[model samples]
Target: MNALIFPGQGSQKLNMMKDFYDEYPQAREVMHRACDVLNFDLKGLIFGNDEHELTKTYNAQPALLTTSMMVFEVIKSKGINFDVVAGHSLGEYSALVAAGVLSFDDAIRAVRLRGELMENAVPSGAGSMMAILGLSPEKIEEIVGNLNGVYIANYNSPLQTVVSGEVTALLSAVDIFKNAGAKRVVQLNVSGPFHSPLMAPAKEKLSEFINKIEFRRPNVPVVFNVTGKVAGTLEEMRMNLINQLTSPVRWTESVKTMDEMCVNKYIEVGSGNVLCGLVKKIVNAEVYSTDSIDEMDKLEGVVKNAEIAEF
Candidate 1:
């Protein structure tokens, strides 16, 4: 079975899927449609030279969503079928759209507001995230357990765990982790401490917005980052998206859930293979990405062979 995984915030880059956008009419339409809904120069932000503007949380979230959907359209045009889907952090919106649980316009608008709410949740420079490498989650948890303001944000893998909190407290905890023999503790360049308690206010406001959007049952199973498993009902899925703001992303367990579902192939349907690389760390599965035409063609061949084998 094949699982389609979408990447989140940090996976974005300049002119993501621009080549596919130029070559594929379906991909082009996705971009054009996003431009209409966003009512701003989204292409300009993504394809432009202003790094600061492109990197802003509000801009980057919507841009990544649009690009992922563009890649999804291209993959669909090729007649590929993914049995399941999942995404990291902001990428969940893309997965939702892919599963037919949310419309593209709703997703775009939701993420734009999500980014803004998250951005203003805390004062600039007050919150931060750091990746603690080469450490078990339990070990990191035990070490930072009592440290006020420091909380685990992403259980990325057995080898990597991200912690977020007040900047000074986060920095202080970093020194503690480094001393505890962590391989490396590098601070992330994010504007706010996402997926942490600091986002409680954001979660409240987003809940009201989410209540207004219509949600449908997912056509395919969608592994959630909050629970690392598929939601049982549409209401649960909606609540999960809202609670995700203040919850740590259970990525490692999410991958394991797909493994349990016998999903042997993982196609990263986004501009970058950030999620692909993460999956490699967790499961022994064939991986592919839609980052380029060559990759997509290769994935199509793989899908063709699988279909032939089944026949």
Candidate 2:
């Protein structure tokens, strides 16, 4: 079976979907709808010269959603389909949209508020996230389990893990992590400490906003980040999304769960090939990413080949 995966933050780049927007009416329609829902000229910000503004938490959320949807529309039009869907962090919203669990309009608006709330969750310079290379997330968790203000944010891979916490705790834990065995500890350039206790306020506010929206059962099942498993029920899906705000992303486990579900092919439906790389490392699946027109052309051949192999 095949699964559609979506990437979250750290995968966005300037004018990412510009080619799609130019080449396909479906892609252009997605962007136009985003602009209407957002009530702002996202096209100007994304295609414009101000890249810094495009990457802001508030802006990036909707922009990524629109771009992912653009690619999704193009692929779906080409008859490409999937059995399940999953996403990383903010990418989860994109996944939800793909699964038909949430409408794009509701998702874009909610994530915009989610972004704003997360941006102001903690004071600037107070919260931060960092990547720990060549370290097991379990070992990293063992070392920082008792540390105040420090929490594991993403279980990205066997060799890569992310930590989020207060600046003071982050700085102090950096040395501890390095001394404990991390080969490299690089700080992430994100605005706030997401997926941690530090985001409680953001979670509270986002929950209030998201809960008001009705969540329908997905057309296809979704692998949630918190449990690294498929959602159990409709309310479970909604609850997982709200709980995701302050919970770590179990990316590695989620991929493993998908693998066990007989998903042998993965198509990353978003900007960069970040999720593709991560999926490759986790499983021996045929991984594909669609972020440009050329990649979309290549995807036609891939889907054909896969159908032949299945036949």
Candidate 3:
């Protein structure tokens, strides 16, 4: 079986999806629709020279979603399909669109608002996130169990767990993690304390927006970030999305669940290979990422080879 995954923030880059925009009309349509929804020149912002503006949370969210969807559409046009789907953080919105749970227009608008809300949730420099490498999740959890104002934001992989909290707590945890034999603990250059209790305000605001949008049943099962399980119903999927803003992304567990389900291949259809790298650490599956035209052209043969190997 095969699973399709999408990347989240930190995978975005300037000129992302430009090849699709230039070569495929369907891809260009996705970009134009995003521009119309957000009422801005999204194409310029994404493919233009201004890296700083494109990196902002609000811009990055919509841009990444658009790029991922553009890639997805191009691949779908070529008759590619998957048995299940999953995404990380902001990438979940893109996954929903791919699964037919949310329309591209609604997702683009919602993610724009979602980004703005998350960016403004905490005061600048008041909260932060850090990646703690070379530590087991259990050990890291035990170390931060008694600590206040700090929370695990992402269970990315066995060796990479991210923690988010107030600036003071984050700085303090750095020393404690090092002392606990962590290979490295470095702060992330994010706009806010995402996927933490600090994002409660953003979640609250986002819930209202989510309530307004119509969520249809997904065409395929979608593994959720909050629960690391397959969302069986639309209502459950909606709630999981709202809670995901303030819950740690159970990426490792989600991938493990797919592996347990006999998903032997993973295709990351997005801007970067970040999720592919993480999936590699979780399972010994055949993983491929298609972010550009050249990569997309090679995906069919790759999937075909994997299928032959499986049989």
Q: Cα lDDT of all candidates, in order?
A: 0.93, 0.91, 0.91
lDDT of 3 at 284: 95
Of 1 and 3, which scores higher on lDDT? 1
Rank the models by lDDT, top first. Answer: 1, 3, 2
Question: After TM-score superposition, what is the CA distance of residue 151 in candidate 3 from its true location, in Å?
Answer: 0.3
Candidate 1 Cα lDDT to native: 0.93
Question: Tens digits of per-residue lDDT for model 3 on 140-196?
Answer: 999889899999999999999999999999998898999888999999999889999
Q: For candidate 2, write residues 1-311 as lDDT tens digits.
A: 88999999888788897999999999999999999988999888888888788888998988888899999999899998799999999999999999999999999999899989999999988999999998877789898887998999999988889999998899889889899889999999999999998899999999988889978878998999999999989889988999998999999999999999999889899799999998988889888889888887898898888789989
Residue-wise lDDT of candidate 1 within 203-272, one digit each (tens)? Answer: 9999999999999988899999899999999999999999999999999999999999999999998788
The prediction achieving the highest lDDT against the true structure is 1
In Å, residue 77's CA in model 2 sits off its true spot by 0.1
Q: What's the C-alpha lDDT at position 161 in model 3?
A: 98
lDDT (Cα, 0-100) at 220 in candidate 3: 88
